[model samples]
Target: MPLLRPRDGSAGDAQIPATSAAEVAEHTCAAEAVFHSGVWSGLDPRERAAALLRLADLMERDADHLAALECADAGKPLRECVENDVPGAIESVRWFAEAVDKLTGQSFPAGPGVLALTEREPYGVVAAILPWNYPLAMAAWKIAPALAVGNSLVLKPADTTPRSVLHVEKLALEAGIPTGVLRVLPGTGAEAGEALARDPRIGALSFTGSTRTGRRILTAAAETNLKRVSLEMGGKSPQIIFADALVYGEDLISQTIESAFLTAGQNCTAGSRILVHTDIAEEFTRRFVAAASALVLGDPEDLDTDIGPVIGGGAATRMLAAVEEARAAGARVLLGGTEVPVVEGGHYVAPTVLDRVPAEARILREELFGPIVTIQTFTDEAEAIALANDTPYGLAASVWSAQIDRAIRVSRAVRAGVVSVNSYSEGDLTSPFGGWGESGFGGVEKSLRAFEQWTREKAIWVSLHG
Candidate 1:
């Protein structure tokens, strides 16, 4: 049977059914025309802000429909879509809309006889590559800033979950964004994604996916036009459970389970690495396994289902292979180690936990990117920090302790971009989101910092004597 296509019908027009090379080329060409014509880039700040607000409103109004589509495409729980992803996307657009007018160029003190000011201008066009998990939310993370700063966007949604992005494009068009301003090419990364990165007309590229893929995009951008690249990539973040923590009781176990299993552990910021004090490692593992084992793996449309499937069959296979490899490397599988059958021919992996994971295992070094977590024991504060920073990723981390000072100290010691104290996976729209090392190069700030990323600074000097 032919693969299912995007609802926009752009696929059929290109003679490349669904997510084909031809569709990607056509979409890239269309986006280049939009940039050259200066439709979105020419809009004034007020007009741009209004258009963004309209898009937010449209997303809010159609939240249910979009959430349903996301559930179908990504296998995320309906509740997650309705309560988290859609709302998060809408809030992102709204935040950027409010920031449009607030984005200002820098002014410098000039000595005698001259006024020096720096003006900011848009990059003209952006290529946004979104991942399969949390497709709508990640797309918004790039789209909101790119559009708010007056740039046209060519979005390439992941092949496994491109339907929600097509919905986003439809909503943008309905929200008064000019034609061709926000075009989507639903194709594989090799064709459409590489094309967008290599296209000279695309002045910048913002991506959210794996670290390996981010490197490829960076190489492509450098080789083609030296376009700017912003990447939010893979993470093997740590959740430290110190012996002094009050929240480390039953509640901690529950919170950790939720964080590890949210979106079936598909989140780039998921606390997949558990660093427990050696004294408490055994108890923590027991409680964690109990909580994770109790989770219901079923249809995502059901509100009561705690854990749903990963994105696609390929994702599921990769996750399972990682588990087997960990087992082979002597990691103890405490709870789940295989796939769970679900209705509608869905792909579901059981919430899995590996205890006594050696530091040298591939599962500990690389991102598992599934509902699986590795538990490692640390003898002291120094050991904890070392274990946390052992992986190539440095996206986010969390520390749990009753003593605020120790928690603060440990949180500061971890080499991650964002650290949560006594909390797991809480991302505020006001804070900057990005990573260090192999995670990514830049951040997505809810404030003016995001707009600065999309703009070029031009120095202007005026003669005061004249």
Candidate 2:
């Protein structure tokens, strides 16, 4: 066993004894045998549903401990972990618990004297490689549905945040998940991640990370058994604000700030590129910058901390490079764009606002996963739609206008997986969440739609006389 150090590259957490490549293969093979044996999959669907509900119950019981571990490991706000992350994780599992039983097969008459029906069955074992942010919630998104559909799972937690998922594995077993049904492999992309992706035994591989790594996972799978692959990749999502909306709307400034800077802008759906109609661009820029400047950047463990450190020093360095690159390209920094004062190893970047960044600027186009936002102006609805849809990446987008018709038209025009109107929400558990374009290929990850990712449909034909 290799030691999996749980550090955010700033300070180190306790070492997690990691499984090696060979061990990962061994575990996946064992999980495959268990899955093929049908010890779990053979159970009634209701029984599978019951097991997940029990796991949800256990998770709720351990919510405080899990939330604390997430904050300590990932440096996300403790308040967010409690209010959003943990609760969201629990709710996701519970929703799948109920959905598994309700999910139905189809039957139809095929012409005369023949009957046709369809059966939905699980892919034997699924391998999920998840990122450090939203560690437990991501686990819930992948783990709950895979299990609900009667597939075994090999979960490889990010190197930076391994503690919570391992604890989750334990909780699953305690809630009566069979042995070998779920394995948590804690190691790097080179080791455990590669082993899981290339293994011929894995039926599907779902990853949530950078687009760069998503390409690697896809190619690696291609070389092997060509396992089913799903990726939820990067985003430079835009928040298009029309002058009509801002002119009459109350609290528009506050709402826009929430969309851009929540989770310190680490969210993939974050509206980092704000497109304002030129008529109200100046006033909106001033209000947006002032509001962004007032955000409190402090220790994540505190309830009052609005913006915490980035995941690590390297992440902060990348963000700083982006800011400098933007400045060098003639983009003006309207608010904080420098590194925050820090002790020996804490990685903090000030919440930055760039004024009317040119369309060609790096800050305007690239996905910088930090508390940095850039504004650009559009003269008309067509220009706003063009600007919002300009990026190669299209994971999420938002259109703001009091006019429902115009908002809907703009939302449709933006080439993204998820588009919100007026409000900025990451959709609920019942909504399907996935992406389009360089955002990578995948079926939805939540709601009834997620069942598509975990199962394949088999059509059956029968003679009526038989």
Give the alpha-carbon lDDT of every model: 0.81, 0.87
Give the clash count for model 1. 1
Model 2 Cα lDDT, one tens digit per residue, 1-466 = 6787765543355888777889998999899999988888889988988988999999999999998888878888888898999999999999998898777789986798988999888999889999987899999999988999999999999998888888999999999989889889898888889888899999888899989989989989999999999999999999999988775454788878888888888888889989898899898888888898899888888898887778877888899898888888888988888888643455888989887566677777778899999888889988888888888898898888989999998888889989988878779988988999988777688889888888888999988784
| Minimal lDDT window, size 10, model 2 | 4-13
Candidate 1 clashes between residue pairs 3 or more apart in a chain or in different chains? 245-402
Q: In candidate 2, which residue pairs get closer than 3 Å at backbone N, Cα or C atoms, i.e. clash?
A: none
Best by TM-score: 2
Please provide the root mean square deviation of candidate 2 (C-alpha atoms, Å).
1.5
Model 2 spans with C-alpha error above 4 angstroms: 9-13, 247-250, 342-344
Off by over 4 Å in 1: 1-39, 247-250
For residue 449, what is the lDDT in candidate 2?
Answer: 86
